[model samples]
Target chain A: MSKKRLPNIIAVTLMFAMILLAGCAAQPSGDLEVFSWWTAGGEAEGLEAMLEVFAEQYPDIVVINATVAGGAGVDARAVLATRMQGGDPPGSFQVHAGHELIDTYVVADQMESITFLYEEEGWLDVYPPDLIEILSYDGEIWSVPVNIHRANVLWYNAGVFTEQGLTPPTTMDDFFAVAEVLEDGGIIPLSLGESWTVVHLFETVLLGSMGPDAYSGLWNGSTDWGSSQVTQALENFDRMLDYVNEDFAALSWDQATQLVIDGTAAMNIMGDWAEGYFKAQGWTPGIEFGWVASPGSSGAFDALSDSFGLPKDAPNRDAAIAWLRVCGSKEGQDAFNPIKGSIPAHTGGNRGLYDQYLQSAMDDFASDAIVPSLMHGAAASPSWQQDIIDAVALFLGGRDVSAFQAALVAAAGDAGY
Target chain B: MRINRDRLIAFLMILPSLVAIAVFVYGFIGWTARSSVSAWEGLLPDYTFTGLTNFIDLFNTPRFQIDIRNTAIFTVLFISTCLILGLVLAVLLDQRIRGEALFRNIYLFPMAISFIVTGVVWRWLLNPATSLERLSGLNLLFHQAGLDFLISKWYTHPSFGIVAIVIPATWQMSGFTMALYLAGIRSIPEELREAARVDGANELVIYRHIVMPMLKAITLSAVIILGHTSLKIFDLVMAITQEGGQGYSADVPALNMWYTTFRALRFGEGAAIAIVILLTVAVLIVPYLVYTFRSEVEA
Candidate 1:
């Protein structure tokens, strides 16, 4: 070949080589891209704990965190939807374990079936049956349960309780008596953040006071909304609301939690996640604070578990499956739940790795002293939750309890669940 | 031949911009309009046409109705406030005030910031924890005498949700309006002012009779831009309201459409709401837009 032609041939070969290298670049073997809306307060810290353990366990795998900052996890869901529709699904994304949600994904064949993983790892032998129920859709496990969060725990300042000569109330009557005492003393009995928090506290009291059988009936659409027990639950919520502070509606959860921390409010009826915030603030359980099952609701816990599922046609299917395994594994539970301030899903993991409060939670779970009840994203269909928001807003706007109950029922019916 | 060459050069120069507008603006709009009709909830096209059913549900929704009302109020207030304040500020600045350039830059700086960023900054400014309670805590001797109403809980209360939206919307947009007015004011020929001066017209009189008349085009332009923005105010309210907080007090049409489609997973209804909002905006703006452009062309 001519010298000039030889140079051209070499250049063409280099171009092809560059293209090939770009196409088959050394992508990380376990480059797992996980999505969750955990970019605030204790949630961020909790996520970091999981990442630390994950890195140690799978050194070759890269954990690409796609964290959106929002309290309700709405923004993260929007991003996931857009990405998934664009045919560029994420490796894994956070979702609550529920039949309605999982069924939708399953019907579309949009989720990766993890029944094999569950069977292969013998997860059925360890994880609670209730949790397994939450994780399954159409008789197949499609997601990994991470934490079982009790939504009915009433967090209160222990110092305030002791100062006021109060023990944790065990019944509805006791609760009202103590609430009145706090009210008379000019301390707000409830630190309720306007909308979702009000619903959370209200639902917690309903579940805790009504017990698991009734609570499950209500959630499963078997209990008629017109039933007297349901009406009684509504009345209990109204009674609790009467004890909330005047400034309650305007306050955020963080602000309301601060009120409890500062000993201004006697109690905050919130999910177990609030424990993480308290722990992050250097507060100890049973000293600086304490928790109880909702007043009059004994021996049953309403729980929801946060889990991760792979979207259909996930860009990195293998990596996502690996991450799901880790999420369900003993090490994953050990790393995640300690910082998450919730009980781990893995049965054999050390429950003692958690603080005093979480250990108590673990004890509650093991003794079948708790029932899984949905709060936040897990309790109702998305439509039902939104209607609750609307109804609560109306209720706070001075609508009566009858109106609130009617709206709630109608909204639930409208969601077609 | 010369004119043809000039036209070709001009079209070539603007080809990239024209393509961008067509692809990004018009293309997405067409896509969105199509999506509004279909049952595509999560990403894939569901291809089911529940014609006008989504719209019917959307209109029936108490939340969506409230949003429409809120958006209308916001639009009227925002456009008028921005136009009036902007014109007044421009007139004042055009008086050749001291530090005019600095003030102009300060006024226009909000325009440079994205709406999300503006929402964040304004949220901090208006947040009860950061500003309201902070100010009330100060022991200034004169503080107790007055200005306390500025920190009224009315803005944060559900009944006063519109006030919450208005404050941030005005803060982010008034400056851009001011800049547009300033440019228009500056465009008025010096000879016209000289003629008014010769007739012994005072500043206010001249502004009312002379400068203002000349600024009809600028006012129209300012109102159109501000009106469009007010109609679709989303990020500001989204950042401001917590989930379940005050419910739909500050929920505008766009946010309602978003929640209806995505959060509620009612894509059909969400699409219907979007089309309604789009049609409403178009109905109001198209005629005004035509008039404004025609005047500009004649000028």
Candidate 2:
């Protein structure tokens, strides 16, 4: 009888073993799901490079790449919110500079403090002091800075510049002069993308055109829309719109850059990420593509930095922190920013390690007084930025400066900015 | 009394659908209504009741007003065009035409693709450069005729925004209505067609008097389905026009709600928009649904 009962015991033991195995398998070791919006043309390759290095450092940590592609942060943030609200937050996610998070991240205390990481990495001494200041809230670090993207760079085709017998425009007047020359030469003057982000290019020009103090004043509410500086900036932005592609409203960013790459358009006002696109197309930067400061900014740069934040209640909190460390590390920066085609946020990040255009960007970033871009949802309320988009759209579509300014004033009032 | 086991099984079978409605449908509505009354941001809902504040702000928004007007115009035009075109195709296909299977499948296939996919493909087709380039490549015929105007930056033009919204919607939904009409036509008894023919009625007369009247039930069903879909239209408008709110012309209430909740991080206001849109759709659809249910009971 005891022998017959042995088979039953064996079956029960097998079932228990299976359950134990399943439970063990469900327990992940240092697995982190990283969320970001860098899933387009060249950004994808850059992200892959960063992940490759990350994998090399912590071979046990599994990194899940969750990227949503929309021109702006809209698509990525939307997906992240839905997930977080559904109680499945990613270990880390990308957020921009300024108060974009106050409404959600700060209120919920969902952001984890990365003070120790920043301090331990000695990033306090390396990255720009202003960047460190922006990342601070209530005297604690809440995110890891990844890369500094200068949004005001004007990229032009070298062949087009040569054919037109022109140099990269250094001032508003020069930009228009070159644009006129290019148009006369039967080349498209500017390759504006179809999204609302073209408003970013316009704002970059406006920021530089208004000068740093006046530009910062626009964000800090120190300057009124009635100011002559703002009025002139708006006028120039409107005039510049005339050179944009007729189909600018519907062209994607890559397509806009393609016109430059194909030598159809003379220049494109875009972020450094355009370098990634050019490189992906088998075109070497500084050879097929070139960069210049936004017109009116001789050396001033408009920059937006991308950073990663760990939500407070991340399941694998330690793992998430480790990933943030990797993101801010010199090795990680070298591996990531080259493909990101952005300047590294890591202090003493190896500039010699990057491609030529990015290296040049690093030089400019070092030499220039970088100003905040309003389009990055920094320095102003989202409502204010939204209003600016509306104001810009109306202005670009032929609204008078007075009406556009009124719209801005009204929006500022509405957003309590 | 004898137990009706079949009725019990039928109720059991319908239980999953009823739960789905309760959870996804009713649950979301209640949650959204509660959220609308509270100040919420990001993933967090602030339970503080700022009474009528969000609604007042939403009403004052010019973008919201434009979105409402665009939605209404789109709903009316989209429904009418889809019905008219669907009926034409249904009538023509019902005539025992050659390659009826092929034609039927061709008309029915658009229904199979999801709105997301439909929007993606249509976006490319409507892109001005892409369309013009493709058209010009067609032996200079289109280029000579200046057909470039047909493409005219359809997604961005305020005047053509509704047309842009309609094309993809009509592409996807017309197939559904066509199938309904086809089913209605097929359901007609053979004797009815024979009787019409024997009465010396021409094809148009037979269709107008006999076939069309027979299709009233199917047409009403089609209208109700399409009407509800039109009221809740989001994806096509979002895709064709970059969510339209960015430009201030293409903003639908759903897109507005999304922007408020996620982009703007004003969850209370976003939830308020959601509730308002929910009520609007409910007002349009609930009565029709009740009527349909009553008719089904009578039948």
Candidate 3:
């Protein structure tokens, strides 16, 4: 109640308020938030290993491993869109290279050009020139690709194939012949999953049936979607669907792969991530399951890469740049791809670190013709990809081949192909 | 002067909430309407006026047509099933059975859990390959026990896939409808039923003529509630079938809006889908709202 006591009390209260305000106003200076959808199995372990290298390099930076769990970044992309549109982007986030990054983020002016970082870190020379082209738009690099996943891969149970006296098929005719044998021997010839996996299989079949040149041409306005080649691809796809498991609609990709692992299904045409799933199930690469570039897609690499980019208004700019540097470095790529069951995007990756399947993939990457994957966000924009998925879903449900082709042509026009 | 002062005080008290609703609810709806008529098709909002192009495109798309068909099938099946089951259960409970509270709570418990949970549980049960049949070898058990016909592909059947979705949706909502019917049944006067009995009316005749007619208001309320829920269904379909059945057999407008907006980044088409859903729900709700308000004023 004394005047001196009141002044002392007021001074103490004001000091506490200022301290609290300072705490609230402080920016995340030493924090780096990396947003991704790698929250399960070997993918999560690969990310954790890469983050460990980043941590060893920058001990002061507290890495916020913000993960949105969903298969194939479906949930993460929606969450990222909301956050970016709301102007509260994370420090950095994972994006697929090529049109997914360019059409969605870079074209919208939501991403910062990382060309200078590429030059400074010598990534321009390390990453392949074609990959650099895919990651660039309007003469500027947008994202740093860490790992390359081959989408066109036919994974089979090696034991089943050896016992059935069959080899991995080399052509559509070979596939049907082997499939008939497997079917006669009481095996599901091919294992397939839900709608998206069906789309993935169709894209590989397209690549195999029409060859790489025509497959790439489908996206670049050079090839007609109504061409006979596409019609033949559709016919082959329809025939191929006949050999798939009857319960394809109810299973996820991993569950479908389980049929192959358990020796019930002869083959599954899936991405290289299936290798990661196989390994996580304690199976060796060439011993338990085997992979070849999907049937006729031999001599071509149907590729998609997972990359990270800095948003325009990202918090912790320096830390995000450091994270991108780590994502692009040889150490990071080597550390990531070995466990991710993918190959390093940069050619500088140590090949000894990879397993037998990825080693073969690396060899093919060097010798084979490279093409973008339509199902994996490399060859087309998101809207175009969704349209293809819809068309494929309808086709799987017994639509005519002509109707399926017409739908693709219409969707291609909408995508400005 | 006193009345004017009191009116001013009341307006001041509710001014914040009025502003909040005006901005957050009506303002957002207006924004969505405008966006629906724009050409913002990609990731970013362009907002150039394109008239009814988005709406026309949505109508022309076969997937959207399928969505409309699926919604009609789901709404009719869901609402009628809920009503009949709810009324039957309410009538049975009205017989003054033992463990009445326990039965009531048991029926009402599913209503307390979310639709997402119900969808998940039903998804497991309905999936032939991964459900109880596969997990516990019940399919084998059935085969051994001469019940092989019982092992049928439930949700995975392409033609009747939406029917499979309807089961879970009805399971979650019929309980709430039963509560409504139960309260209506209890509120009915015993004197009316006694009078009807004195007129040589059987239990079925009394229910068909007297109790059912008396519960008209409750039935209307249930219909309105169930109608809008069916119209705006998203989480249940998403959880149950993830990305719809084999050929988008279970696709609805709300799921279409979500994928179009968030996944495909076609904001203009997404807004058009949203407007369509809103209009459908409004068609069911506005008359009921108007009737309730008019009745309140008259009362």
Candidate closest to the true structure, highest lDDT? 3
lDDT of 3 at A74: 83
Span of 10 residues, lowest total lDDT, candidate 3 chain B: B130-139
Residue A14 in candidate 3 has what lDDT?
100
lDDT of 3 by residue, A91-198 (tens): 999989988988898889999999999898988877777678778789999999989999999999999999999999988899999999999998889999988889
Please give the CA lDDT of all the candidate structures: 0.74, 0.76, 0.88
Q: Regarding TM-score, does 1 or 3 come out ahead?
A: 3
Per-residue lDDT value at B229 in model 3 = 96
lDDT of 2 by residue, A141-218 (tens): 777878888888889899889877899998999989999999998788988985456777877877768877677676
How far residue B236's Cα lies from its native spot in candidate 2, in Å, is: 2.3
> Which candidate achieves the best DockQ against the true structure?
3
Clashing pairs in 2: A110-A312, A194-A251
After best superposition, candidate 3 residue A231: deviation in angstroms?
A: 0.6
Give the CAPRI class of candidate 3.
acceptable
Q: In model 1 chain A, where is the ten-residue run with the lowest total lDDT?
A: A99-108
Q: Judge candidate 1 against the unseen true structure and give its global Cα lDDT, from 0 to 1.
A: 0.74
TM-score of chain B of 2: 0.87
| Model 2: residues with Cα > 4 Å off, grouped in runs | A1-73, A82-91, A101-103, A313-319, A381-384, A390-400, B4-17, B130-141, B144-151, B188-200, B245-248, B297-299
lDDT of 2 by residue, B113-221 (tens): 8887887777767665433333322223445676644435455664445556777898788988888888888898989989989989888898889889988888777
Cα RMSD of predicted structure 3: 11.1
RMSD for each of the candidates: 11.0, 11.2, 11.1
